[model samples]
Target chain A: METKGYLDMDLLRFTTAGSVDDGKSTLIGRLMYDTKSIFEDQLEAIERSSEKRGDETVNLALLTDGLKAEREQGITIDVAYRYFATPKRKFIIADTPGHIQYTRNMVTGASTANLAIILIDARNGIIEQTSRHTFIASMLGIKHIVVCVNKMDLVDFSEEVFSAIKKKYQEFSSTLNLADIQYIPISALKGDNVVDASKNMDWYTGKTLLQTLESVQIISDYNFEDARFPVQRVIRPQSAQYPDFRGFAGRVEGGVFRPGDSITVLPSGLTTKISKIYNADVELQEAYSPMSVCITLENNIDISRGDMLVKSDNLPNVEQEVELMVCWMNDKKMNPTGKYLLRHTTNEAKCVVKNIAYKMNINTLEKIVDNFEVEKNDIVKITLKSAKPLFFDSYKRNRGTGSVILVDEFSNETVGAGMIV
Target chain B: MSYNLNHLEQLEAEAIFIFREAVEQFENPVILFSGGKDSITLVHLAYKAFFPAKIPFPLLHIDTGHNFPETLIFRDELAKRYGVKLDVGYVQDSINRGTAVEEKGLNPSRNTLQSITLLEKLEEGKYDAAFGGGRRDEEKARAKERFFSHRDEFGQWDPKNQRPELWNLFNGKKAPGESFRVFPISNWTEMDVWQYIKKENIALPSIYFAHDRNIVNRGGVLLAESPYNTLLPGEKYEQMHIRYRTLGCMTITGAIFSDADNLDKVIEEVAAARSTERGNRADDKRSEAAMEDRKKQGYF
Candidate 1:
């Protein structure tokens, strides 16, 4: 009734990658059910549809397959978001397809995720799909990976099989830049080691999947050493009460900011002190990463949208030429000499592909420099020359200021996504 | 040291960020208001976003001419208090102008006609972006919607061909004639909305609170007896205490039996309720994919 405690919970965003039969939807359904997030009307509607399809059991996939074509094909065509909450944390799941064709979609889903869950079937241990998902997760800079060995009931909850799969996965992913990798044996269909402990596998003493999700250390996931704020808009309330109130409004992309902190404005190199930081009328002493606040400078300086505010001591690279790894998303082949719109942070610039260095072989983690052509679902390294200098950092250092999206001018479609190298 | 924001404060901040983005990118934008709690909350956020100055965008209300009287009163009062411009598009004008025709049945509702009126208004006003208060957690099909949903020249939505929206960087690029429907509170759920309303102390229409009214039962849904609603052969109007979970054309919207007259009681009822807020709408009961079909044809 009075859920006062729900207000204080922190938010956790995660991405899930699994094949069609990996019971990914079933696992999500169980999570919602166990947390009492699924309403009765929705459950009844899914049940009615399941009965019409002549399913032996309630098809949990029906809950997430929102599109008509997706339900007819019985496969996830794109990313679908699902929300649930435990008493400890609020979770947002970006459910993505594991098929090789939908690699772009998986990347799109994993772009904003702090953690990734790679579902593996117990029968097929450490397969190519597992490697492909892990490689993409690492490329996206996901710090946490949870390898869920699903359908353990089919293997009689054998500890040897679990250990073997875990060992093989570790050996394969030892080169990845992941900080935390965990293994959990689960049976989504039978509800084993998902939300509750499994009696069949008493040998496994680790926490359940939900327990791990709720207890993960995510506050340190953000970079708190460098302060970066990309000015989104200028809030000028030209009224009588505050005639000259000009506030720079934006969300803090990294680090912490406080009043009286000396800051440097990029591209113009103007320096000033933060006069005040306001979050809807309440003056905050400090603002950190992901907090949206309006800030006023001590002195009036020339600043506008598409500019960056950073600590004068620690600055980012301000350059006109940038090297990046891009994933082509559009069906049309990329034009080698084509000029497109590159949007990064709050700035948009006209950019052209300078050179195609190499294309990554996702399956083998090999770099092929012979091919210069870029097509759909192809990840390639390219150098770009922008019309104006962009303030950015490496994608590995901070995801907020390091990512860019390319838009086709003619079609106005987002055709490519790039991470600055 | 780092400080964490509460859930309500976080949602509020995210919504304000989206509002500022809409104003900065689009040449002409308007807020699609329905005098409901969600839109009211949006208006409040807009006020906070550009404080000391009026909201840069105008409020667009598609009037079906079959709404509750209290809703209209509240809409006018809110516009005056906030000093924001209000634009009303009438469905009856479309009907009289031969642009839209009424359905022939025992219970004919103007719910579907709002789409035509909305499109006509957008074309007439040359609005490049329209802000809606639609949330993803409201219905099944909406769960896949992006923050910036693209619309064709004809105002039709192609769900399969939507652009991939990643991170906070929304791709709002579009052709000249094509427009975008931006949802600021797309991530918020029903519970989140209620909690925000309580925390912000935003005013809502009186119809949301419990009151005595005349009602008639139709296919297990309690319909508020209004002038536009025609009773069936065996149905009769009876006095009952009820409140609306959602607001729309009076002919199609259903009221729930509740005793939650205050905000606290309403929150408790919402927390314990089993059905979704949209479960009581008679328009959605027309088909399983009613919302999806309507969304494709450019209905908010």
Candidate 2:
């Protein structure tokens, strides 16, 4: 956990996963309440609801679980998002339910997260749930992991207990290709080491959760080395003021785009020079990741939505066949011969599942290829062939351009999300 | 020429991109103009989206018949300046046709009835899509809303059955007679909108700025007095310096006591405010899922 300094306006998305009673919601609530992110009226409403339910203390878990049945059962059953901002950075917390039934929801939330927080109970440290979360985090390409040994107060804040659990998890994590892993001892029930440093834990030396969150470096997380721009829409302001104005409107997914840079529009193979960049009339010298801009070419070459603008020498692979790690979201099973909508970048094309290569065992990281069936919530390795060739990199290269989602045409619902392997 | 985009400018660019995409994707899309600051900002974004070209779509105003006269003035002036067509769907017409019944007695408002008229107008005009200025930061339910919201033939939105929007790829596929509701500024917060408005120097309705207005303090809320609001016996009206956090029917929209009279000051105030802006809208006070329930019924 880095707390060396502070910068302004940084953004980091992280996911929280735990089995049944790890106090994930309490940790999140404490973070929000201590940081003043919780409003007065919302607190009052929660207080009233808690009193009505005859609970002595306000149920902090109620803050995240908005569904009625979950509230009645006192358990989370789906992925609920909660947003809070410190002056330094904005945080989007995907509170994923711990139940095995909602594995799809957990995958959906953790897929886009930059970091994954795996909570372990002091009483039951490094159990099956811990392995399940750790495997999912690694599989989803979450590079950073923070293993918080929660409920330390129940174990009398024992240093031996924390060290034992930490050693075991470290051994398992070594097999994974995670970039950064941090261990912390905290009691979420008593608000220890969440927002503020715990007074009792003098044996541990690390920044608190809030401090770690605010100072964690994320600017380097995006792929800024490859220049890939997917054309979203064509901007033609054919008014008398700028009648001949023609620009390719889209967002820069990776790398930097500048004027005078020679670019080529993919799928059409039309080459052109960057004439100008406009974010609304004001010309920009350069634009980078996540910044939307309209680029004008020196030539009036044909370019439309779903087209890619990339450097000719460093272009993505244009392949009709793609292999991916697919997370099935819908209840229906994946049909090998069924046609589905494959959306990657801004391009949408029809695709068919060529084969189910293997299925992942959630608890144990084993590949099951013999009797493969992609049931709901099953994260499987599959091969797909699109009607048209898609220009894309592996999901590891650029999350924005490499990831894809499968939509069922019959129901018009996104049935599965995939990362190109 | 290349440009360096500031934070708000970057957000504006994203919004403009989404707006133009909606224009190309939908057959006949209309902008839902409420004359509020959010919608006012949307108008400016749409204008910039086409730059020298006229905005490619018309503006749709679901007039509740209880709106402030100032809002209507602002709406008309905006349409006239941009040379864009404005379509006003009146709730009174829905009531006249007995399609929507109005609530009576004091606190009489047409907020809920506006949905019926809006749906009828969309059906009549055969609008394939309607663009809104809604943001996720407004409420809990809104936080779950997709950028491209799909509506059934009955103009109802199903939150559970949303199309997964991934990496700027918006799927606008819908069944026949079904229309989509596109929100270009779905990711922006209230403070972000105000900051963008200040940075862009976008003109807005006067009610957004602080001014002397006759208001009644009822149930600890500063409710602006209007013809539609029938005051109760003990409620006393007084003049106060206040500004509206949002604009809707004057009967349902509440005012806040503030000294922030200009765009910069409003932005600063919004940044420092502890409560959500939609907290001022009395209609949401009805229940926890007020916005979600209304949206499920196609109330934009």
In TM-score terms, which candidate is top? Answer: 1
Please tell me how candidate 2 rates in CAPRI terms.
acceptable
Which predicted model would earn the best lDDT? 1
RMSD of each predicted structure: 1.4, 3.2
Per-residue lDDT over B1-300 for candidate 1, one digit per residue giving the tens place of the 0 to 100 score: 446666677778788888888788899999999989999999999888766457999999999999999999999999999999999999999999999999899878899899999999999989989999998888877888888999999999998999998777888988889999999998888888987898878899999999999999888788888889898888899999999889998888889999999998898888888888888888886777888999999999
Best by DockQ: 1
**Candidate 1 TM-score for chain A:** 0.98
Clash pairs detected, candidate 1: none
True contacts kept of 2: 0.26
Q: Report, for every candidate in turn, its global Cα lDDT versus the true structure.
A: 0.89, 0.82
Model 1 TM-score on a 0 to 1 scale: 0.98
